[model samples]
Target: MTLRHHFTRLICAFAVSACLSQVPAFAARQPGPEQDAAQQLALQAQRAQMLSRYQAERAACMHRFFVNACLDASHKQERSALAPIDVDLQAIALRARMRAAEAEMRQVQANIAAAQTGQHDSAQAERQSAARATALAQREEQAAARARQAAAGASKVAAPPPVRPETAPPAPRLFPAPAPQPAPQPALNPAQRAAQAAQAQADYAA
Candidate 1:
């Protein structure tokens, strides 16, 4: 009977413990706006510090004999330490993106609703789209004009200058002017020379 009573007490204790476990020990804390802002600031500061530390460690590793190994080890350590921070940051960014997407969807739906109610007109939307297209075309045209002008300028700068023929000094004679031929030798006597001269004069006359 005592053993049975002891078992009954143990069962009762277990049931009570189970019930308590089903209830939260304390109310779950919901972050308020102020807390969220503070947390964001803290995270930003932490991110900056972490990046700074990583940079310092990387710089120090560069001085090591086995720089690649040192840097790899530092990167592993940094990654391990920053994993949680990165996850939190990614979660925050994803939540913001989701909120933005939801807002955009709501806006689109509202516009559709307004259009269904005749508050918006298709023609007006078409006109706006046309205006945006016209603006884009004008911008593109202006960009193309600027590009053409730049190309022209670059072409002008890159083109080689016209070649002007430089006057060259007269070429040296290949063969020296024949030395002035010596006066014909007086191979014959003065009388023969006079006779030859007379014969030349007679030929010229003829």
Candidate 2:
């Protein structure tokens, strides 16, 4: 039995002892009431009725010739009657405490789970942030390299090619270029050619 059971029994035993110091008018000749009371069928009302009956029995026992014997019997009966109620009370209290403990355990587990989830989420966020930073750094490096290449290309396009030193104007081209010759005249037609021949003969005769 639990501590509560022992305590309840101790208390009920004390109550029984107290009631035993009574007269015959309060004595119980039969044990039926004890049996019925032990069932604790109706806890509050029945237990009260049982206590009253015991008190009446103790009163009746005061009138007995063997008062001590009657009182002893009455105490035994009362103890039996109250035992079931005490056991029931203890069982009920134990069940309630167990329920409370179970609820507390569940709450603690829920809190732990929540804490774990928060940590996991925080870790995931940190990882994402790191990945983004790395990607951004790579992009910046690539952009810088591209900009440098573009600047080099632009410079190459803008600058002119190098020129060599001049020589003595190619030595004045040796002699100057000859003057252009006149074009030759075309020969005359047949009649014009005859006129020109007759003119030459007349000149020779003169």
Candidate 3:
């Protein structure tokens, strides 16, 4: 009789607990319009942040391009202007233009070098990532191939393992430090002063 009563109590308790769980589900319910509006605002804020980041990156790239173009055009204009002068002064003009062009070209070359370095680093990283992905894919494919072979032997098929994409590491910096400048010296001695004075007089006479 006691055993029968205990089983009946256990069964009743379980039924009541199950009924209670369902009531919470019915009562809790999804969020209404105000909650939905709040969620939408949050999503918009997130999207705005993403757009800002995109815009900043775009602006930096555009600025670098514009600087390069301006430098090249300016140098071209200078070169074409210097081509029609006479012989001795023509050499002078040519030298001057060449010097200007050399300076400008060096600036452009530095810019180009920096850009090429960036591109090369980006390409190298991409290549490394590609190689890693290829290796992973090949490993997965080999694994799948082996699995398929095993399955064929055993009369059952197995799914291939998934390959995950990898992010490349940051490129190494190529910036060289500025060369150290010599420290300033103290004033010259009396003998050094006399020698400098005599040299200055000679230079003045010449």
Query: Judged by lDDT relative to the true structure, which candidate is superior, 2 or 3?
Result: 2
Winning candidate number (lDDT): 1
For each candidate, the alpha-carbon lDDT, in order, equals 0.70, 0.70, 0.59
lDDT of 2 by residue, 1-206 (tens): 44455445555545544444242322432224344345445676767888999999999999999999999999899999988777654444444444444455555556666767999999999999999999999999999999999999999999999897776555544688899998987979999999999999999999
| Model 3 local distance difference test score | 0.59
lDDT tens readout by residue for model 3, 1-206: 34345445445545544543354322354344455456546655655565565455555546675766655655454344332222223333333443444455455556656777999999999999999999999999999999988879775435465687887888998898999999888899999999999999999999
- Give the per-residue lDDT of model 1 (tens digit) for 81-108: 8887876565444444444444555555
Off by over 4 Å in 2: 1-45, 52-75, 157-164, 171-206
TM-score comparison, 2 vs 3, better candidate: 2
Error of 3 at 77 (Å): 43
Whose TM-score is greatest here?
2
Candidate order (lDDT): 1, 2, 3
lDDT of 2: 0.70
